[model samples]
Target: MGNGGAKFKFLSFSGKFRVLHLTWLAFFVSFLVWFNHAPLLLVIQEQLALNDQQVKTLLILNVALTIPARILVGMLVDSYGPRLIYSILLLITGGLCFFFSLATSFEALALARFLLGFAGAGFVIGIRMISEWFPARQLGLAEGIYKGLGNIGSAMAAVSLPVLALWFGGDDGWRYATGITGIIAIVYAGIYYIGVRDTPAGSTYFKPNKSGGLEVTSKLDFVLYLLINIPMYGALALLAWKVEQLELISFNVLLGIWAALVLLYLFQCRKIYSVNTDVFQGAVNRLQRYKFKQVMILSLAYAATFGSELAVVSMLPMFFKTTFAVPVALAGVLGACFAAVDMASCPSGGWISDRFGRKRSLAVLLAGAALGFALLSTITSEWPIAIAVAAMMGSSFFLGSAAGCVFAMVPLIRRSLTGQIAGIVGAYGNIGAVMFLTVFSFVETSTFFMVIGATIAVAAAAAMLLDEPADTMIEVLPDGTVQSVAMH
Candidate 1:
């Protein structure tokens, strides 16, 4: 059999299967740590005597640092390798979690939670890790499983943390719930470092020519890459504005953060040009060059898909409780369907891309997600509660599948820069969430759903702009010989 036709043996204890299991477990724990406070936030708030605004600030801070951290982590993953980066991230995240559990003041809790956002960067690491172990033909399914199964960590956090807090049954019970996740992460960090390899034996691990930022193929792409970076920093600026508006930080502090972000953006642009400076010199070969628009388009797609998923899942329980007059527990269960459905939807989305086509599959799923959200916009008290939930579940399936389809294409875009590309895409997902949630602050629930639908429609158009993956991509082997890896 050709190397491209790799069949994943899920039951196997060795080879790529072992790598897949290990990497996804690492990702799961990262997410588990990342969202550990979410379910127990109420208890944490009560114990700490936090007001509503302070609670909101914690949520914002949780994701605020993650946007920029993903970009930095992406570069690190490409420059180093997933095995090392993942271990270090876990160790750092564990320490932050421990710090958070010991917090007495709001300042300490906020700082720890903000820094813990780095754990979310673990997802991009697995994208690079799995892409290394799996061949092109199986890339989508493998990545889908990594992303999908790992996402279950968020749900697990929601379900287990609260229960653990109750079981511990005290004012500081939430701390124990949060702290235990740290111990688990620290233990597993060592296991992952010991067990995982960057790549299988004899396979060359590819690195970017320049590690500062992404390398673009054309002048237009360079311009586009710079323009695309605005939203990432802009989202952070928006967070600062929100916190300032809340009076959580001094106005001058907010201004300083804004200034710092501007300087960082300029520095990043300088790095981008420096890294890809040789592109204009005709130093890059045509066969090895990949379009940067592919990155931009996929980033937008992820912003709408996974980004919308993040926004919706955050608000779904409250939406269900108020609209349907359901009990909180029932609403929680109903809302969870959006995330719970990822198990099948993500893999199915990837498998469809593998079987049929990537661009077409994403476009179809995005369009379906649009329809799902559009349907959600019209639901009201007059609508049957069951039917409304079913619509939400249906939309979730589309959105989840579209998210899977986005990753399906991420690995194929440029293999060596898969981590960086995943970083950009993943950051956009967070950007989308921040924007959607910000919009949710003013808009009604139904309107929020409609806005997401509109976003997905635009992303569908962008998906059409993507050039389908060619049958083969050229990669350099360790001995300097080139090989054409199968794309399908």
Candidate 2:
């Protein structure tokens, strides 16, 4: 009970569900702040006198740090626990948003944007918190609702923030509008810290076997782990290079960034070795061993699935404006449809995963997504608007379903290391987005969709290779006591 980390017993369904509502709302609020700039950037750009390259730089910086931030925050959540980490993250992001609002120049705005990327990492914390409260059977639906509903904030921001900027009026109105969002973030962080508990009563919380490293069962796993990490850091390096191309970061800073990336990769490799040392010693027992190939496959699947969705959502509105020759506002509204249905379909994906088989449902979802995106690539200016809209929505439906399917397997992968696993997988999703978007910067719209379609097909193939979930996964409680948790 000391330090306000109290363990309370869950006596009522109302209490547990209330926790779910509050936790998801916190996530919702974080996302709202995270994406508040996207819709209002047009206004900010004109007001600040920023050119196209500068604006693109801001966008790149906005997501540049998220890849590593997710991994670092994942470790912090697993070590210090989510209750404290999530609250602090909210507060820090709020402060950064406030800084972003007051920026007077492109450089200051870019710095704030890069720092603000950390908000995207907040999703990893809730994965652990939600897993603690809900049983395995319901975890998918719970996580789906949490992520799917929370994701709506971006769409909502796109719809409302423009109008909010107008309402404030005058030259500096955009700043005030963004400031209000920051204030909401600060207020909610305090509320969450006071209101939430990390775990339900009469339950043992699981922690990773070691701190500061991801445990692997074999030497090959250690090597595969290091190989998989390259892209995550590389994504950041790519962002830095993009910024340099836009003149956001100077040439010297770019070289420094490249050097830092090499060092970080080396450090990561050392950690992988540290975590897998027991496996090399032949001290890992059968109960403690898990297939690392599963982790690698899921990471690749997530990169293509969720990553493509992130990249597509960022560019689809612009594509519609150019291809369909529509008003920017209308194009944005049409693009919003891609994410809008997720609020419903994600929960449906989770419910379906729970009722049917986990692996089978995920495979079906991935297959559907690949086909949907491929169909979407066939759309052109010659097509009717209705048909195009339907195609895009279909693509998002399958993508959202696949997102639900991925997290449906996240908690089931390794019960104790759920946060770290979710973090790595989530980082791959951002890495996918960055890599795909970087590709989009060079390719045409039709080609962009085709590239994404091909990526999804690859992920679908990986989904076919994934092992099915079983009845249970093993975890060790704090007292060094092992327990078997249901995977249904």
Candidate 3:
């Protein structure tokens, strides 16, 4: 827990610590509102008379818009600063929660959930704000604390929302429960706006030179950037296909969605070109150059780590119940241990990255995650349940740690591009979930675990190619003054 030269204080309410507290709280409220619907799905379905297919569609729609929303929000965070963007996001998404609560029809619920996915994008906002406040040496721990604690919002919603609903008592209890979270978000939006600044006094907040797409230093990187965007669009198309499989949409409608995706891809490519036209002209200075492969490798590693976490969390309870013959309630509690470990494991991973070398820490953690999953694949009916649970927890620790390590390196790559970098990496996490869950649909639990293990192993090898971030990065201030920002 090195805090550059300053003593690290967890309870302090001044300096960077205050900003960290406020920012993570903002993120916490966003996630709380984002997932408030999940635990109440049963009540929602019953009250709205939703069929099984409609319920599943609501689930899919909840995460559907997050991928693009993160990218769009990241660009805005970089352009306008996190303070304003975060406040507004919380304000608007909070209102959407109210709309979701009041929905009297299936279509209204679907639309509200889809729009509420934008709340997931709030994670990217704090990455930039924290990076601006903390020095490179302490960034991993700061970010780990921010994300690790903030992430608990989902777990909190799962635990508390049901209780709150019960306490409210009645058919509309779930609605009141959901609406309370929205009220909290709306209130917090105001607190966050008045409580925090984007950076410390006398520090500069750097903005990207171009707006529409990520800036690339080389023509090769320019091409790589375009190629990397294909999977994001593909993931959205996959969601549409899944909806169609549920007979929620017509085949013709699915084709229309795919066609629109292709067009959006082309439009994004044009934006990428516009942002990096300087690369084509050979005008980017050598010192100013960074390898886009860093972004690519981090994205792949994140997809494997966080992606598997999302997929596993959704299915682990069912796997436990069926494979081990555990009671439903017990299986769910046991399964939640996977996500519950994030509080400690995420910060430990970031602390390890800070104490050791970033590349080595990430590669080893990813490799460990692969091995952990491989061990998980060996679970069977005859095996002791305690051992199985231990294996799952062990695997969860590695997966969470690897995720922390991935973001630990994100802000270091390019200061001005941190938001976009975090956005792309964060979006890949959702893409990975979509891909792995799709695989699970066609395979057994053992096979699903094996696939994730194998994918992470490949990412571990790729992690070897990542260049260590430099000791200092150069950024241009709005005053046309070149400044050096410390990394370590």
Candidate 4:
């Protein structure tokens, strides 16, 4: 239904191409809004006279909801189509952005920041949308390009929003600058809703039969699935604990939230069993069911790669300033080089996976990442800045490439469940970020790097377990019509 031969082919002429462009544009806008506060946060801190703890609290609040949001959004995307779900998300997120911009008090800003976490759900929708449009042979590279390009939204915010605030040129300049990005988000919401479809006009858009849980194929897989779900909720509980430590909420409130999360877990498990009732009824052939192990492997892989990348990037500026003895401004540029590598390597990694073998490419990249982070931990201020830069580049290259490798396998697992699969995998990246950052908070910087390096080594070994995608996957569409899709 889509193009042939090239995984990185441009989708400019096809209707699917338009959908891809518009959908990614929508995602890009969501991200731009999502991170608009980051670069401008310093300005905000001065304006509001926030203590360092309050500033840290705001940063924590920004991503706190995203862990659960991704999981819930994945469920919603599979149950509803991307068109309606994505559009509403954009609208609501834009409103939150506007609210944040207009906030005059710390409390108002905090609430607005929390609501903005929903925008992080944007990634899940496009994973499913791109999977629907592209075939298996190209899914890895296609999804990689979509994710890589859209992810640049954070970089865009870092580079542009600060300048925008300066150009606006007043005490209130930041507000106007952020508000403009919000307006762009609102406008794009309408554009995407009208411009995109879940699939081609004649192509069937498959949905899971049950609304609340992931469908599993076996008792063992179901148990594994439940185990995988734990980290998702545990990540949420971790965030609640963070809020409590920051005194943002009371201990009792945190406990109540934790209890509610437990109940939610039970309800979700019930749904998993209900939807996967067929698993116990019939003995399905191996090829007929997706491997739960694959999901686990990719989850760990992303936790190490994208997860570590997120953690490193968060602490990068400070790492560079302290380790290399550079000025704050200079250190920021050096830090960016680490992230800038993603611009090229991320897409390249996907292309490599599509052309080379998926597992081989991932294994090779993860090995490089393990080595890169290990080298990073060995650096000292006495070393040349060039040497440090080289090390950071090495780390970023593998991280970006490994991200490409992880997603290359995401869509291949379950065609109809691509959103949920990508969601869970994506959530792991966020979890990695939180876990790695928390470790960084307690340990020396060198130890933090070494710990992440060790984590990547274990993940690299797991990469060996990933099987290259098979030739075809059979999906029963909504009308109970069977279809076989090609895999590379």
lDDT of each: 0.89, 0.82, 0.91, 0.84
**Which digits, one per residue and each the tens of the lDDT, describe model 3 over residues 1-488?**
11346566778988789999999999899999999999999999899899999999998998999999989999999999999999999999999989998999999999999999999999999999988888777888788888899999999999999999999999999999999998999999999999998877777779987899898999889989999999999999999999999998999999999999999899989888888888878668777788899999999999999999999999999989999999999999999999998778888888888879889999999999999999999899999999999999999999999899988899999999899999999999999999999999999888999999999999999999999889988886667677777776
Compute the lDDT of residue 253 as modeled in candidate 1: 97
Question: Which residue pairs clash in candidate 2?
Answer: none
Off by over 4 Å in 2: 1-13, 250-252
- Per-residue lDDT of candidate 2, residues 1-488 (tens digit): 01111332323335556667777878887888888888788888998999999888878888888888888888888877788888998899899888999999888998898898899999999888888777777777888888887887777777777788889889887888788888988998998898888887766667777888788877787788888888887888888898788776699999998999999889878877876688788756678678777777778778887898888887888889998899988998898788787887787788788778777888788888888878888888999989999989988888888888788778778877878888899899999998898899898877888888888888878778888766778777777788887654
Please give the clash total of every predicted structure, in order.
0, 0, 0, 0
Question: What TM-score does structure 4 among the candidates reach?
Answer: 0.95
Model 3 misplaced stretches (Cα beyond 4 Å):
1-6
Candidate 1, residues 69-140, lDDT tens digits: the string is 888899999889999999999998998988999999999999998999899889999999988888766878
> Is candidate 2 or 3 superior in lDDT?
3
The residue-by-residue lDDT of candidate 4 on 20-88, one tens digit each, is: 777778788888988999999889999988877778778888887887788889888888888888998
Q: Estimate TM-scores for all models.
A: 0.96, 0.94, 0.98, 0.95
The order by descending lDDT is 3, 1, 4, 2
TM-score of 3: 0.98
